[model samples]
Target: MKQTMTNLKQLIRAGRGIVPAHTVIVNGNLVNVMTSEIYKADVAIYEDTIVAVGEVKDYIGEDTKVIDADNKYLVPGLIDGHIHSECSKLSITSFAKAVVPCGTTSMISDLDEYISVSGLEGLNEIFEEVKASPLKVFWGAPYKTPYTFPQSTVSYNFTKEVHENVQKWPECFGVWETVREAVTEEDENTLGAIVEASKNRLPVFGCAPMARGKELNGYLCSGVRLDHESYDHEEVVEKMRKGMHMLIRESSVTHFLKENIRAVTEVNPYLARRVSFCTDDVTATDVLEKGHLDNLVRLAIKEGVEPMTAIQMATINSAEAYRIDHLVGSISPGRIADILFVDDINTFNVEKVITNGKLVAENGRLSYELRAPKRSSVLTSQLKCKKTTKEDFEYKVDIKDGKAKVLSMNVKGPFVRKRRDVVLDVKDGIVQPDINKDVLMVSVLERFGRNGNKSLAFCSGWKLKKGAMASSAAPDDNNIIVMGADAEDMSIAVNHLIENGGGQVVVADGKVMEFLPLPVGGIASDLEPAEIARLENIINKAANELGCELPEPLMYMFFLPITAIPDYAITDVGPVDCIALDTFDPILELMEN
Candidate 1:
């Protein structure tokens, strides 16, 4: 909050006096966003704050500066409720250059790709950049296990080290998206970290799906300040009733845009203002093609939402929820000069944008700032696999006798679906792939630490490729991903990953087709978003080479180990029941022998 206050004071003084002050804006609809009203005025500005805003001359002096705004419409600068800076496939600097021109002046970003650890010095570097930049960036601490989980048990992934650092540093606006299974009294590391945040008055975020009564209160008591995972509209109201801030999400994973707009304003009426909007995960490619906040704002309007209400969801409501309300959410005198000029208020299409009092974009075209990227320290990652062979992925499920029941685990939705214990006949001790059921082999390997921890299981969903469809998803490229029609193809996939050191790879019928060498954290590319997306497309084709028809290969690529959001999933050790948090029968129908 000090950040907001300091910036506010700087703006106040900067507009106080001088050569017509620095600059002036004249003759436009000065959007009095403070009350959702708009009025015509000859606006005057000095530096980054409005000095005088009224008809003709309300407070203008002799040496007033001005920019002709004859027939233009002005509104408060936009704020994205939540997004990831890393997901844009760019450094903070690069991402800013790209989006600023698109009129996104501020964002609450949760970059899980960057791990906060023992030193936390590196993480602080990024935080400092966020504070000092032209585009305001709000940070959220990562709740994801940086290099653990989905491999076997939740052990070795998250540790007390993260808790200790957060207890001391508290580098983010708050903790983001915590799972119940990831926390416990025995392992109160993250739990304690939340307590520390609460003591320090920092917000702790949570995701309690369909939770009620005790479960809901339990989550709030644990320090979760807000919830973005409330899917049902009733649950959204329930959370608000419980005094927890409700984050209405609209994204690829969950679509709740129109629903929330109706629920808050139409259905509940009283708690309308407590709700907000967010797109949890948007890739860099989508950032370029569809637009950032443009997509959501347009969707709301198209879906019959009031223009003012939609803007509030993206701007004012977000600011208040993050507790930075005093700094932004309006075009008042002391607020930062992040304003948007749109042609039409109802349609809400932006024609010009001013961020920090400088022109960032005009029309739909981005006035991109192609400069050197802001660098952060301590980014070290690689893919490691030794002597990978087709035989490594091959297994005989037959136990002594020709026929024995098998175990299968599966999840249905989210990234972590459900676990099942089904037994199937195993011939020659090897459980064969069930092409009819969309069940395929899956595995998760240790990437960062040198434990060589490899867990294996069977999953359903990929409609077969004759060979292995494999990828090493370390974002740091520290481990290999190998899955295929047979052990022979699986080995082929692993061998290619082994050769690349770290990246995504696919092998079919003994032929290497697609590979992405993400040697740095396996999640990011040193290259630009376009380049990475092009390779990602090739990887998509390779998934089709294995005869699968999914929207994006990476979605499936990510599903291999997500343990919370229920889905039929396979890990390095075995199939995981996300709800149960345990291994199940491979087939998940017949009893395990």
Candidate 2:
């Protein structure tokens, strides 16, 4: 509150000419996101707030540091409306170092990945780490925990006590996206939690992908004000028409901006105010190679979006969606001096970045040091699962006669979310995976030392003919998920992950091939971005060598256990029908042929 009063005084004093500004940018073309206009101006900064704009030569004091813009385009520092810091495979501090240089000054992060591992303790740890960073980080409480029946391995029951505790944190912006299946099912516990979060007037984030007509309306009626999963322009337009803020996302796993940005550029440009850009899930490799939110803005401009409009979507639109525009989203007075200098407006090549009145990045390199988060014993000891054997992953089918119908997760691609049922031949009175037909055994084992639960099922489209892949980074649960043609190789991979405290592992012919250990909560690693990227590349190369046909083999394997997506997902309990929010029998009775 004292900081608020101090800012108000600075704004009033600067406007009255009673005090000179601390620093000034002379002769610059400012991209005003609020007005969607570009005009030549001089910006004056008093401390961390932009105190004046438009010809402020008199406000410059002798003690102030002046930066000559030389008519370069000044844009508000980019903000990622939604992201998961853990997806970068780096700690929050390391993730900041990687993105700040790319001109991402602020981000709203969903720490569900960490929360799913350590509950509220994990969330608090992440919040403190982010608070110490140079970037502006906003928190979104994990909305869906224990997302499936029989409970996830690291499930935190979203009880009233936990919800109240989450609300007490000032950094928490809102409850993150709720699973569509829970909302559609009208789960009283989920609905009550939303009400509890809304008591503070925070916006609820939604996750209703492919929800149309009444289903979409039902989700919105539950107080969800924003969605980041809309994949097409039609979905974007429909959501915007219904008063939902659409966050067009371009992540490593999915690319929706090239097609969805057209919703504003061609269909209804005026509705662009209701849309924003987000990187829901991206890795360090993508950020270092392709850029961060700046990549989204450049792509939008190249796809025929007006320069100012694209900037607005990346800046003020995102801020307004989260009700934070008054703080850090524009080049206006009383806002934080989070500004960027772009050499080319059309290409969005950011030359320099400033956050909180300090020069954080210059020439695409971080000019400051980023400290890693202090590790806790609990965080470092995430793998507590007992040793596993081939029997744990075996699927014993009781066949009295011949063939039996089976249910399989038919993955067409990394992004497709439908399951298919197929009939397969049973051999030796037991159901066996037909690797010759591209059918491989998939399993999810409880890894958080809870109940020792495990489930088995068959999957297609993995295209692995010789080896098995396993990772402890499965979404929402952080369970050990592995798919393999040979049960021995699968056991070797899962046991390696268990012995290494949790990580991604690939095994072929009962031999360890490639491994990347993530000792931090079994989800994130303390490794630097370059090292993590190197390990990830090695894993991908091994997967390709093993004949894995998925576009993003690691990501595909990780997301297989996320029950929030449509159709079917495997959990520790069994195969879940996501739309119905219920578990179905893995074995199907064979009909007489």
On a 0 to 100 scale, what is the lDDT of residue 560 in model 2?
80
On residues 1-593, what C-alpha lDDT tens digit does candidate 1 reach at each position?
Answer: 34578655655554454225455566678766557677886555555665545643433556655566666777777777766555434556556655665567888765555552112544566666565556777666655454223334321243445654554454467766665555532236567666666766777767666777777776667767677766567778877888977777776545677676666656675564666677766555666676667667777778666777677767777788888776677776656667777777676777788776666677665465444334443443334436555545544542633443444445344344444444444655566666665556666665444556666666655666466666655231223456666777777777676666556777777888787775434444556556766776778787886787666555555545645555454555555555566666553332234
Task: Supply candidate 2's per-residue lDDT for 456.
Answer: 89
Tens-place lDDT per residue, model 2, 1-593, is: 12778767767897655788878898789998877788999888887788888989788777878999878899998999998778667778778888898899999876777877887777778777876777888777766576664345674556555777776677778887776777777766677669888787877888778878998888778888898987689988998899988899999978899889888888988998888999988887888888999999988988888888888899999999988888888999888899999987888899989888778899888887777777887577757678888887777766544676788887865556676666777665656677677778899888877788888888888789887999888877778899988888999999998888888989998899999888888888877777888888899889988998666687888788877776778888887777676777867776432
Pairs in steric clash, model 2 = none
What TM-score would every model get versus the actual structure? 0.84, 0.95
Model 1 vs. true fold: TM: 0.84
What overall lDDT goes with each candidate model? 0.61, 0.82
**Shift in Å, residue 65, candidate 1:** 8.0
